[model samples]
Target: MRKGILIFTLISFLLLNTPVLAQEPLNNIDLQPFLKLTMNVTLVNTGEYPKFIAVNPTYDFKTFREGDEYLLHNTTDLIQLSKANLILNKRVGFWIYPHEVLKVEFSINIPMDLGELYLQDYADLCYPDYTITWSTKRITYPPSLGVGPLCEVVYPHLINYPILVDLTSFIQVRDPEIVIYSYSGEVEFTITNRGPKTMFAVALPLIPVDAKIYSITPNPDMNYTEYMGKFLPTYLKSQVQNAKFNLTQESVLFEYTDTLLSTMSSQQNLIQNSITTNEDIVDYPIWIVVLGENSSFDIKYKFQWEFTR
Candidate 1:
C-alpha cells in the first residue's frame, strides 16, 4: 500500500511540470496569392573588383522566408574574362521575399576592371528546379490577378526549356519593338565582333507545334544550322483504354507516342491532337521549352520567325 501511494505521487508530480500546445510557436503566415523572385548580395571586396559577371537583368524582385536557398543558373555569356580564367563561388539572389528588389553577382578568377567588362556576350540565364522555404511567419505580399496568357508550351516534354516568359502575342502589348519577319524563304543575319573574336554563331532553335513539316521558310537574313532534317511532327498524348477503372488515378500521369503521323486511327477527320484539352484542367500549368544551338562560340542574333500556325 505504501509503495503504490509513492509511485502515484511521482507520476502526478511529472504531469504538473509538463506543458501542452498552449505555448507552442504559432504559424501566422499570410501567403500571397502570387509568386515573386528576390535577391540580396554582400560584396566581400567592394572597389577591389571593377566589373564582374551577373545573371539577371535589373528590376527583378522577391520575398522569401528566412533560411531559403535558391538554385541560380550561371550564364556563360554574362562573363567576359580570359578564356583560361574560370568563375568560382558565384551567387545569385540571396533569398526571395515579398517586396524586395534583388541584385545578382558572381565570384570570378580574374578580378578585372568593371569598365573593361561587356555584358552583351553573356548567354541566356538557365536554371533547374529550386526550393524556397518560409522560416519566419509574417510575410507580406500583395495579390496580383492578371489575365491568362494566350500561347501554349510548344516543346515536347523531353526537350522543353524556357528562356523567355511572355508570349509572342503578348509582345505586341509593348511599343517600339522590332518586327520579326520569319515567314520568308531565308533569313540573312550578320554577326559582329563587338567585344570578343568570332567563336560561334548563336540562333534560337524553333520548336514545332506538331512534329511534321512540309517546308521551312527561313527569314531573309543569313543565320544557319547544319544538321537540318526535314521537319517532322512528334506525338504526345495521355493514352487511355476504352475502359473504366477504380484506381486509374495512380497509373495515368500521361502517355505519349513518337509517331504523330496523319494516318487515321478512325474514319473521322484529322483533328490536331490537343494535349491540354481535358475538362478537368480548369487552370492548366504553364510549360515553356527552348531549343538552342550547341556551340563553344559567342553569338547574338535578331532573327524573325514566320510559321503557318
Candidate 2:
C-alpha cells in the first residue's frame, strides 16, 4: 500500500510540473490608413500555460532605384517613418494567460515623403512602397519566474511567428509640379500640388553666376538651415572674393655743397604711392526648399553683385 501511494504521488507531481505541448499563440494585427496611422494588435493564447510574448514592429521599403548608381533616389531619402505621439504606451510586451485574449494598441507617425528635386517622367516610377511587420517571440521561461531557458532554442519554432502587413495602399504618393527660375540677382522656386493627396517636394535652387546672396525671403525648412550651418560655411566663404587695398610711401633727399662761397644747400623730396585691387565677387547660397502638398510656396532669394576693378 505504501509503495503504491508513493508511486501515485510522484506521477501527480510530474504531470503537474511538466509543460504541455501546445501551439504557439495567434497574432492578429490591424493597421489604420496613412492619414491616421495606428495599429490594433490582438494576441490569443490557446495553450494550457501562460505565455510571455514580446511583439516587435519594424518596417521596410521597396523602391525602383537601388544601389550607389541611384543613391539620390534611395528609399530613405524619399520617405521617413517615426512613432506618433499618443497617450497609449508604445511598448508592446505583456503576459497572456491560457485561453485569454490580449489587445495591444499603438500609433505611428504618418509616412512623410521628403519630396523630390524634379518630377519623375512616370507617376509610378521613383516612388517607394513600405511594409510593416511584427515579430512575435514566446519566451519559454517567463522572466518573472526568475528562471532562464534550459537550452537555446532557435527562432521560428513552434513558439515564434512573424506577421507581415502590407502598407502600400497608404503610401501611394503622387508627384507634384515644380518650377524654378534663375534671375540676374535672384532665384525663384515654385511648387504646385495638383493631386488629391498632399505632396512634399524638395527644390534645389539654381544660383546665377557672380551673384552675392543677401537674404532668403520666407525662410526655408530647418534641414536647409542645419545643412548650411554645419557643412557649407567654409565652402561658401571660398567662393567670395574679399576686397583688398594696399598703400606705400617713399621719400628721397639730395644735398649739394658749393665750395666757392662755402655755402651748403639741402633739398628734400617726398613721394607717395597707392595701389588698389579688385576681382569678381561671386557667392552661391545652396538652398533645399521644401514645398507642402496641395499648396503653393514661393522661395525667393535676394542678392546683389559686389564688383571692383
Candidate 2 per-residue lDDT over residues 187-291, each given as its tens digit: 354444432223232332332223233345554333332333443344334232332323122111111112010111233322111111111111112334232
TM-score of each: 0.17, 0.22
Candidate 1: Cα lDDT at 284: 11
Return the TM-score for candidate 2, rounded to 2 decimals.
Answer: 0.22
**What's the true lDDT of residue 273 in model 1?**
32
Mark the regions of model 2 whose C-alpha exceeds 4 Å error after superposition: 1-184, 199-201, 223-294
**Residue 287: error of model 2 in Å?**
7.8
For residues 169-283, write the lDDT of model 1, one tens digit per residue. Answer: 3122122222222211111212222221222222322111222212222211221111111111212232322323233222111111232212122344443332221122111
Which parts of model 1 are misplaced by more than 4 Å?
A: 1-166, 170-173, 180-256, 259-309
